[model samples]
Target: MAPLSWYIALSASLFVIGLYGVLSRRNVLIVLMCLELMLSAVNINLVAFSFFLSHLGGQIFAIFVITVTAAEVAVALAIVIAYVRHKGSLKIDEISIMNG
Candidate 1:
């Protein structure tokens, strides 16, 4: 079995990569994908801790996170579709739907 520290290190690395993507990317779809990567890292941590502690709470919370992430993706994709239909672009810097 892999050590808990290894899992933690892996999770941290994935989270940093995701964070970098979220901060440096201009495309909305890429940003959303990075957000999902970050959430997956969190889930990894949750499951790792749950295994080490012999409890189900962390796993349950991870499930809730997955559920929320799914819903978020659905809603965000819907918004992106609408924005593309209206403005014809997915670049974050080009979005100005609220401008008066």
Candidate 2:
């Protein structure tokens, strides 16, 4: 069996990679995917801790996070679709019409 520390390290690495993607990506879809990756990393940490600590609160929080992430993805995709319709591209730099 893997150690708890291994789980934590993996989760942290995922989070860092997600952060990097979010920061560096210029495409809206890629950015949203990176955000999802970050959320998944958080879920991983929560699940790992819940397992190690034998606590239900972490699991509950993870559920809430999943719910919120679903909502966010719905809203973000809607916005992205709208933006694409207006701008004809998903690139962040090209959709600067709202830069007021």
For each candidate in the order shown, give its overall lDDT on alpha carbons: 0.97, 0.91
Q: Model 1: residues >4 Å from true position, as ranges?
A: none
Q: Candidate 1's residue-wise lDDT over 4-99, tens digit each?
A: 999999999999999999999999999999999999999999999999999999999999999999999999999999999988999988887688
Which run of 10 residues does model 2 get worst, by summed lDDT?
91-100
Measured with C-alpha atoms, the lDDT of residue 48 in candidate 2 is: 91
Backbone clash count, each prediction separately: 0, 0
Model 1 local distance difference test score: 0.97
TM-scores, each model vs. reference: 0.95, 0.93
Best by lDDT: 1
Cα-based lDDT at residue 33, candidate 2: 97
